[model samples]
Target: MADPALSPSPQKHLAANDVVSCNKKSIDDAENSRENVAGETALVIDSAAERALCRKFDFRLLPVLAIMVVFAPPFALLGKKIGPSRMLPILMFSFGSFTLLTATTHNFSGIFALRFFLGAAESAFFPLVIFYLTTFYRRNELARRLAIFYAASNIANAFSGLLAFGVFQIKSDLVDYPWRWLFIIEGTLTVLFAIFVFFYLPKSAAEARFLNEEEKSLAYHRIQVDSSSVVNEAFNLRESLQIFKRPSTYGFLLIEIALGVPLQSVALFLPQIVQRIVKNTIQVNLYTVAPNITGAVTLLILAFSSDLLRIRFPFICLGFALTFTGFIIYAAIDDVERQIKLAYYATFMMTWGTSAPSVLLSTWYNNNVAHEGQRLALTSVGVPLANLMGLVASNVFRDQDKPKYAPALITTASFGGFGILVSACLGLYMVFDNKRRDRRQGVKLSARDVPTSRLRDGPKVDDFRWFL
Candidate 1:
């Protein structure tokens, strides 16, 4: 009703302001939508990358497993014939040479071939080392010694992570890729170390150059009495095969099956697990270092305690329990980003869980087996059988199970739980069997009560008791 120009001017101003505001809102909404799409695309790309990496790792594992199974027993026999000290050096040198060759390979098939040969070279290294330690250390002393030996691997794992981080940082004019430098460095060091060990290590405790005649005699006598029924016995394939006839051998193998999955899972996928909490690649590698070092420390503690207490299965079970809990906790967490500290802690527990069981389980079987040939036989099968479970690990951590990997976690935990049960049952059976043997003989003779020299027939003798 006022002057047309004045009224219309106010309305027009208000209309223009609304239009401008609407346009600005639309622009902001478009920007936000575009940003969201970009973020989603990044996540998809990350997931696909993770899947590809997992597949590549799985492919690498296949050839190693195949070679290990096919070559382990023959290598065990070879170890026994030549002796661990001498045989180990040859293995070290061969594997190192292969590793060096691996650095030159540009294709997948080349690396695959090298890995197969590398596995062949390393087929008997672990069992031989276990057998080797039994020659020098008594049954009770073996755990801590093996723990120390096993700790080296854990330390190497931690060191490798730190090394990777540092190597990745290196900017060089001569070398284009950091990974090539890693292979060259590791391979050279390994070859050099193998050469040193070949000269340094004694063929047997009896042949040890560092020992006095009396000390050598004492060392040999200690093993003959407590550790081995037949000290430095000749390898007899027929007699060695006798160990497989026992029911306990199968039980031990079952435990190995359970132990291998979790062990390999941590070995293979720990960095990926760490990746959930840490988005940065270098940071993930660094974070893994602490957990591995902690694992080594934990292994030392558990091994020392087990040795002090002179028990094996309890600690092995404890390790399994830790593994089970860690996986369960990690899988149960709905949002790892929010509960990052807890998720990270689970990784520590995973390391703790895996490290001790391997040392203790190896010690367990070695403690019970007194025949040198039989020990090697059992170990050849047992260690490789456990390692073969890497196949299970490699498969279960599928591309579809990316991020949480809930199914893989549950499966691994189930194996751990199964290990706990089997180890406990076997342990209990040992306890009961020992008691029954004690009652039958009318003398409560513990395993230590009898010298292993007379118990060479193993459980066949009436006086023989399980080393519970």
Candidate 2:
């Protein structure tokens, strides 16, 4: 069969120097605009009352607003049609441009409009990356690779906090306010990074420039054997709709919602949580680094273990267990000054548990779902639907519920507990289903059987068995 319109070309090659030159040009083009935005934000922030700005706009805009504009399933479907390598860089550049524009906002309307665009741009990214990665690696290898990929976010978070700590100290050199520099510097770097992603990332292993032809064939054939089909299935709505008929799709979505609440609450409100213990702004940012670094390490270890055991549910449940324990402990502690050290340790648990489930849950769904279009549709809805729970987190942790923030902590822990139950139920269902299929084949659990019409459906095909 001929390649699809968005399929990658094996012959489209460029030299390393060309890529470097292109990135340099992109940086140069973005610099002046970044300067202008930073200057405008600085002026507006300096003139406006800071607390009033925080209350009127930042507080109201922070939650429940932009996320409603996000509809990622279509873009996930579009990535299916157009190719992720082509699609992701464009999306990255678009969001980065919006980030740069955000620095120039003179009032609530300007910032609000730009933020909506930013969320719309970002909504498709996680699902696209998950779908893209599944095409390259086998089911067993995916969790670890995704864990490694996700750790980069934790690492970036650590660095960004440290960078903001230092950058915030600059005191109006590049802009009238240091916060304006945050957007300018980060946005410019993101644009530059998008240039590299465009040039370096291959659309598929078969199109990878660094691989020998033999290596490419081996990579492609490995997946072909596993799925009994090539990665690029024909785009079809009938197949997509068929996915909704599966019980696991709804199960995975429930698990995603359960996981997303703590993940986002911690991501957005960790500093605020830490501030309850520490007095200084610099110290609060610095304190966040240790927990994030710990989370990254825990994520990698759990992922490696998941891949090593060739299992999924145990680790996901373990992660939720940890998060639940942490949130419960942190919330239970009323005396911050007396148990500050203990409360600090609880943050480590929250970070560790929250990090693993997000990566693993996605891998779990991808492992179970058979068809390309079905996986795309499920994840497109699943990933953003998970993030949409961020609205719940935002509402739970309002200004009225500060310092202890008992309401938010308790609510997040409850979700974690719910996740644990849901994951265990799903795992049990798969195990029982697999056993029933094995028994009906007149085969013992450990034995190989003669191929029959049922068996001939192939791995991940009509006769697909779930991975425990």
Candidate 3:
């Protein structure tokens, strides 16, 4: 204490410690700054990768819109002859091969030929699937099952946007264009899946390997009793053609015509529609994702509810109403850019409207038709006929109609309104006819009370009640 220099020298010691502390603090700050920069960079990379993946998936699906109106009867007949389990894989493999070959196309003519074959290959898929499901599930159970199947399409629509986004971002030396990669990836996946389905799927419930002898017998019996007029019936073209003689067939086809227009309108031009709200192409693709997802979710909910309630027409009508409202809302708005949120919400309504009706309508007609061959015949025509309306949608949404596309929206809305009217009339007719049968028989027997095995002749039979 007396000799400060010789002693501890507290002030000097404190100063030295302060300098050390300052150095440590500076080092810590520098390390933290570096860590923050690294973290930010990683996050940016992850976000970019995710966007790219989404874009890739989206772009691949656009080719699906270019379907050709090939006659479906031959394929339907083939399905009947070979069974859908085998026929489906063959079709899938053919389409996948064509899709793969499309990647090599250097000119429009080459791509056009591939697209024609692709469309031909896919033409019978939905009709065959509808026919196949009816072979297994009961009428009441069919809607939800179809909903589950159809949900994949809606999800694809959503992912198609993301896929397109992701795929377009692909900068590679291996492939000159991003589209080639899209075709390659989609084709490979389709071929692989086709192979897997070929091995795994049973021709009929009776042939299912997962089932024991008892379960197989039970499944077959269930379909025979409630689903089909004749389980595993032989294909008869003359007999199948007799389905057209029924006035109801004409009515059903008319409804399909109405459904097709709005459906194709939304599906083909959703990107264009979203573009009005979002100026950026990438953002347009991204925005479409939510609406399509919402459509899928809505489709599932309505289908499940329809199943639970054991009704189809009401749900179908509700879907039409939504479509009508969506189109009207969008069309009514003068400045979509000004009210962006509302315009965006209208697109969601449009998706909700179109998704449910397609599934329910298919289920509705299938539920009513007990004969397997006739059911396939009608579906083959009806589904493609609906798809063919895309031509009408394509023409109506002209280049000049830019942003709002008022004329196109109005036309689509008109079709939605027409669907509601047609479905309601048909539903009412079925109800009155059922009542007339009940009065004549002097007994009240609901459609569910009588097994479909008894109603093979459809409306011609006294025991028949329309599965409305």
Top-TM-score candidate index: 3
Which one wins by TM-score: 1 or 3? Answer: 3
Better of 2 and 3 by lDDT: 3
Q: What residue pairs clash in candidate 2, if any at all?
A: none
Regions of model 2 farther than 4 Å from truth: 1-70, 171-174, 444-462
List per-prediction Cα lDDT, in the order shown: 0.81, 0.75, 0.82
Task: For candidate 1, report its TM-score.
Answer: 0.83
Residue-wise lDDT of candidate 3 within 1-468, one digit each (tens)? 387667767888899999999978876865564455344323323435333432432232212211211146788778988998788778888899899999999999999999998998888988888788787676777787677677777877777867866887899999888889989988887888778767766788677676667556666666776678899999889988889999999888988999999899889999898878889987888898898999989999999999888888999999999999999999999887689889999999999999999989989988888888889999999999999999999999988998889999999999999999999999999999999997775556566766677667999998788888
Q: For candidate 3, give the lDDT of residue 182.
A: 88
Instruction: Report the lDDT tens digits of candidate 1 across residue range 129-177.
Output: 7788788776877787777777777877777777876777777766667
The TM-score between candidate 3 and the true structure equals: 0.84
TM-scores of all predicted structures:
0.83, 0.80, 0.84
Span of ten consecutive residues with least summed lDDT in model 1: 61-70
